[model samples]
Each structure stands twice: as structure tokens, then as C-alpha cells.
Target: MVTDPRPGQILALVGWSGSGKTTLLERVIPLLTARGLIVSTLKHAHHAVDPDQPGKDSYRHRIAGATETMLATRERFVLFREHRSADEPDLALLLSRMAPADLYLAEGFKSAPVAKLEIHRPSLGKPPLWPDWPGIIAVVTDAALPACPLPTLDLADPGAVAGFIATRLGLR
Candidate 1:
């Protein structure tokens, strides 16, 4: 496969479904962009999803055994593909497709190479995934623990986290 020429940063926002990963990303994007940063996001879907309506041309193409389908407009383009029996596309593939951007934030792929920040709430009663994984760079969580080995920040403070990322990744 051809490689991407973009200089991209990868950070993953991972946590339980309700952990507010998307909400945080929604806020982070604007803050980053305001600072003149170009950002793109990649979300890993765990289920069979169809971005196009059933019986639509794109949908039919997928249902008819096409390995991949592309939908494009003057302003944007979307590629929908069926994995069939293939292994999920790895992080490299996603990164390669990223537009030339300052950063590429990923919402899932917990085991991917990208550095990650896990979202957590004490009431969720689930332990942080960091213990089982080593790629996490920091954590943005509301739950206060005795002491974490990694830096912890407020979940609501996207700017602070964005700054931290900028510093850590030398984006600043």
C-alpha cells in the first residue's frame, strides 16, 4: 500500500460507550482548529454499519459483494467498505488516509500504536484500561484515584488536554 505523506499525530480517546469520548472530541476539534491546527478523526466501528441507506446505489454496491464503495461530493467524500473476512484495517491504514493534518485523533482501536487517553468516571466502577495496556500517554477522567502513574486531567478541560497534547507531541 502507498504511504501517506502527511505529518500526522495520533491520539486515541478510549473508554466505555458513555464515557464522553465524542463529546470531548467535539470540543477539542474547535480548540485545535482555532489554534490553526488541521485535525482529522478516525472512529472504529464495532458493528455492521451502513453509512448509506439500504437500496441506495452505494448500499447496493456493498451488498452486491463490492469490497469497497466511495461516495463523493464537491465538498466531501466518504468511503464505505465491507471487511468480509479480512482483519480489520490497522492503524497505519487509517493514518495513511488522513488528510495532511496537524493531528489525527482516533476514537477506538484500543490496541493500536497511537498514544491514548482514557476517559473514566469513578461511578462507572470499571478500572482504567491503562493497567492492561501500556500505550496510554495520559488520562482525562473525573474519577479521583489515590495516585495514578500517569498524568491525570479534568475531563471537561479540553483546552488543557489539548495543550498537554501539543506540548507532548511538540505541536506547540
Candidate 2:
């Protein structure tokens, strides 16, 4: 399926560790938002991560076999749950749970259907992940890749990458 057009756009940033994907994304977010576009980020994690503290009621509920638990305060809230046997939810499910926004910036989930910008570092001893992944719309790399089918942006110029994204999504 294509990215949701309702909320504006969904952009993915994919790369190997230490290839500067996150750093570029971090820089791009503010620049995009400064132009009056709403933005949210989704980061894929391989390890168990709990934004809540241990021994808290919500944490205890999770450890006590509760399938789902929600904690709320005056202005904020969090929902926690554990999956028993089902596969982890995909991009659509995660996006569904988020508040509405003009754009969504996703990091990782390299295999998802979303259009992506891959960060490449030749010194990492790995070939470009682009040629095999046609969904990659662009590349941010220091090394030259002549036969690359995708547009190449300088890794040092975060603005250029952000501009490309804006152009691709037809955003200002």
C-alpha cells in the first residue's frame, strides 16, 4: 500500500548503525517543522524498551499479566501492552495509534512499504542497500555511486535531504 495521504506524508530514514541516519533526521525535523509542517517520529527498536519506570503501577500491571495498561496524568498519558503470540504490528497499526499530524518521519523498518532515504557509508564494509531495495527513493552518502538508480544527496547537507523530501511529498 502507498503512504497515507490523509495526514500528509510518511518518510522513512534507513541506514546501518553509525551511518548518521538518526543525526540527519534529528536535524531535518526542526527544519521541516519551522516551515509550519507538523511532524512526528517513529523509531524501531530491536530491544525491549519501556519509557515508563520500573515498579510503577503501569509497569507492575504489565508484569502482572495484564495484556494492556494505560497511565494518564493531567496533560499526558501512556499506553503499554504486551503481545502474547501475534507478530509485532506493522507501520499502519503504529500510525493508527498516533495523534494526527501533517507528516510522519519513521526511522528503521527498512523492509516496510514506505518510501525511504538510505544513509550509506562505504567504510562500513558494506555495499549500498539501495540497488536491492527499489523502495529507496534517495541516498545520503559520502562515496560516489554512479550507477545508483536513486537520487544521491550529500550526507553533510541535512537541508538538501530535507528539501528533497519536501519536493517528493509535494510539500512546501
**TM-score attained by model 2:** 0.90
Q: At residue 58, what lDDT does model 2 achieve? A: 87
On residues 1-172, what C-alpha lDDT tens digit does candidate 1 reach at each position?
2134543377788888888889999988888888888888889889966669997888888889998899889999888767787588887886766567788888988888667888877778777887887678788888776677889989878989888878887785
What's the TM-score of each model vs. the native?
0.90, 0.90
lDDT for residue 74 in candidate 1, whole number 0-100: 100
List per-prediction Cα lDDT, in the order shown.
Answer: 0.81, 0.85
Minimal lDDT window, size 10, model 2 = 1-10
Across residues 20-138, which tens digit of lDDT does each residue of candidate 2 receive? 88889888899899888889899998777789788988888888899889999999888876787658778888888788887888998888888888999888988788878757889
Relative to the true structure, candidate 1 has a C-alpha RMSD (angstroms) of 2.6
Evaluate model 1: give its TM-score: 0.90
> Which residue runs of candidate 2 sit more than 4 Å off their true CA positions?
2-8, 73-75
